[model samples]
Target: MESGTSSPQPPQSDLLDVFPQKGLEPGDIVVLVLYFLFVLAVGLWSTVKTKRDTVKGYFLAGGDMVWWPGLFSVLMLAWIFLPIYIAGQVDMYAGAIFIQQSLHLDLYLAIVGLLAITAVYTVAGGLAAVIYTDALQTLIMLIGALTLMGYSFAAVGGMEGLKEKYFLALASNRSENSSCGLPREDAFHIFRDPLTSDLPWPGVLFGMSIPSLWYWCTDQVIVQRTLAAKNLSHAKGGALMAAYLKVLPLFIMVFPGMVSRILFPDQVACADPEICRKICSNPSGCSDIAYPKLVLELLPTGLRGLMMAVMVAALMSSLTSIFNSASTIFTMDLWNHLRPRASEKELMIVGRVFVLLLVLVSILWIPVIQASQGGQLFIYIQSISSYLQPPVAVVFIMGCFWKRTNEKGAFWGLISGLLLGLVRLVLDFIYVEPRCDQPDERPVLVKSIHYLYFSMILSTVTLITVSTVSWFTEPPSKEMVSHLTWFTRHDPVVQKEQAPPAAPLSLALSQNGMPEASSSSRVQFEMVQENMSKTHSCDMTPKQSKVVKAILWLCGIQDKGKEELPARPEPVIVSLEENPLVKTLLDVNLIFCVSCAIFIWGYFA
Candidate 1:
């Protein structure tokens, strides 16, 4: 049965299935509530006290950080892709909880409630809050996942027992001929069959790398973290840390998932449509709930709650990041493009409001996500990304490295790539993937071609399109090439002479924040400013009440209180030079990290 769907004629067993016999106990509830309170407190406490009124301050957290951690690709993600991803996260979270706990509506409501709590802190505190909360969540996630990994290993008799039991963990009701419920032959391998495996070896090697590039280097969500870094060294250091951290999922998440099937094959590996639906409301499989099921069944009460918090932490971390980035892209890139004269205050408001819009849209898209990719969240994410994001990755690669790439070339390449991707996307949506025992009626393009392979094709086409178009178009000017391309990045900054304002002073001010006026216009502007000051004198200005001040504070608006706004600082150019010792240390760490990653892949292969 579809989740959240009710029957006109109720079955006699409806009441018995209304709630799970075992779920969060009193201790669990207390722990979960405490975690929620702590998260909210972190969000509230992390709000930056100064400079949030400015666009730079709010979205970028005042652009001052010792360590932490793009418009076209951002726009694509914000308007088209992010909502779907967010929906997937919601589905994953809800499914995790719902599969073992409560009714679908109650689970969805809880998810939305969590979203609201997340938005409260994220919108009010901006990126600073996100960073701070993310730190806390990361800790919680690590602790919980590591604890679960230990338990899972112990329960399964370690790696040797896991490998032996995984193949034996089969659903009794699964069809023998279909290979529907059987454990994968290549489950232990990272590099699998080039043609037959779900994640083909060639596609995983080449195809996955494109989206990784877009995500790591170009996508707003990831790039924003690095942008907040104090300097290039900090950014590189953060990247190094993240590279090492990425390898943890294989042991913590993937192996634990396998352990779940080994422990409870009847539910986690259930392949019969009716049995699967009864277990998790996804007829395709219940593998998505493996982690949560393990958490609930294996962990004790307080720990189960901690594990729930971990699940929630993971969800909120992702949601908050996406929310902030989407808001930033919409407010700074899209809305600002449409309303060039929009004030910083207006932009801030729009950014916060856009978060709400995202929440609504993502909620509406949940049903679609539930039905897609055999109800597998990971597959849905990877498949959709493969369809749409390879073009963006290719475009970013060319723009950064190739001096010939002009706006026109990039524009046409994006359009062509998007059109092709959309064709495939639409076809996939229209003709959903069939079950293992069912006839595969999906178009041969989708059935025969894996998403990873499609991503490779999409990226190649985009690369060719961009190169050809750029070659045919007028070459970019020196000004455009300077300080923009990879080759020209180290060139010294050159200031150009300011020209007399061709547009009106207001228009000029709107465009560049500082007005560039001719002598006559300068005098006129001064006179107008003087008149405005006289008209809005201190005696005539209304006093803000205490309540108003509190409201503004909650909204993250700084109260200037008769103080003059400071001049905006010029953009800082971070020196790339790192101390030799630090550089050597980082280099060694990089080598170690890469070697470890390769060793794992080879071992698994």
Candidate 2:
């Protein structure tokens, strides 16, 4: 059963005593400090070399785009619908709450410190720093998780012993607790009864896929990474790498959770509300305690510290990413729209300022998030996304594939779907899930209809509304759309149609089978690309230049002047995934990933 509240008490000191655990040792502190220092050093180093004033340089990691239309969809299908990002960190917000309760530390202080660390690196080096730090975090996360998994499996006498203990505990829990705060007997099962299961079969099958699609394929937050790759091959290769990484969560996070439940049933699976609250400070349940609890309880001092560092790395990595992206979107897309003539220095300053603003907003939001899902981090995030993302997914999928999807249709469809979802969100907040022992006196629709199911209904509404509205409106001209859509991306004719009608510079003489461009035409062509496609800096007045130099120096940039950079080719947003070798590799990888997923679901099922 779901439960939530508006106010959360600070984590209790006796948290470590909940399941007979020792406090963090000095080595743990040293490891954590070292990790923080390393990340800060790397971020600042990136800042020294970074040109933060430019859009592509700042946000895109100075890399180009590679569009994916398949595996990312599958990637979404795996934990979210696989383990997914800031959301990962926000999910960890609940984790932080648990850690606070267990370690008896001030969670608010931890939150502020993390925000400070994340913002500093993020504001300094921008996207590149986020990427590099993420790589290091990934390695640390993998090592820490695998190390703990090994210990957990050994402690429980391996898989066979794990299952025996878990089912025994599960059965005993039901006998005593009955329906109150007892996990479903089909807890390990991924696909179960749509109506009764927390993860309904129907919702798992189709409903959750909608949001995953939006997140993996469409959301700027994710696609930004793909766009940062140098070429399409590298992009797909990066995706394949992500595909491999996706396999880690179940083994590392989810299964370890089950192990913890078995090992500390009295605490992790505390049935009584008062007893449960006494254990980890969440009356609803202590399911969120599985990770940090295991790390603290199982691992010895040094490894425990390393694991702590991993958690912090994950938290910081996610936080920095979120801050970087929020700032990028605000500065590049929205700010530019508001001030088209804004100078580069002004824009960079605004973007860094925006990161600070986001930190303030996130800090303010921590209490609401922790309380909303009864300290269940993943659930809170999913419930929120189910309300907001399905409509966006519907618009994007339709817009990309269907030529008839027009701006007016998208605008109104989004407005309608959002209004509906917002109504649900407001209601969900007002009618929070009651404690397990409390009467199930919730509204039928709110109580019975799952968020995943609602996702579908909302998506369907958006699609139909958009389609019907488009039919009545004036269709966009083929020329206006050009090669932006899947329907037109491949044909060179449509690609040409997208290009403006100005005379392209002619190369007069043939040299080594390549035409040599005339000097005048080449110069003319460079200016055209800068003005039309690239984010080039404008010349500043003497006084403005002096201030810009001072600002740049303060931000650790080398110079006040613009650098002459070669024009890049226009980005290809949609491409046919028709390469034989690449397709073969992807196919093989997909099969492996899917097979692994099926094995996991079947094991749990």
Q: TM-score, each model?
A: 0.88, 0.81
Quote the positional error of residue 481 for candidate 1 in Å: 1.6
Give lDDT: candidate 2, residue 318.
Answer: 68
Write model 2 residue lDDT over 312-335, tens digit each, in one string: 887787677667766777787789
Clashing pairs in 2: 77-81, 78-82, 79-82, 85-88, 188-604
- Model 1, TM vs. native: 0.88
lDDT for predicted candidate 2 compared with the true structure: 0.69
What candidate 2 gets wrong by more than 4 Å, as runs, is 1-20, 49-51, 64-92, 98-103, 170-177, 493-584, 602-605
Worst 10 residues of 2 by lDDT: 73-82
Each model's lDDT comes to 0.74, 0.69
lDDT of 1: 0.74
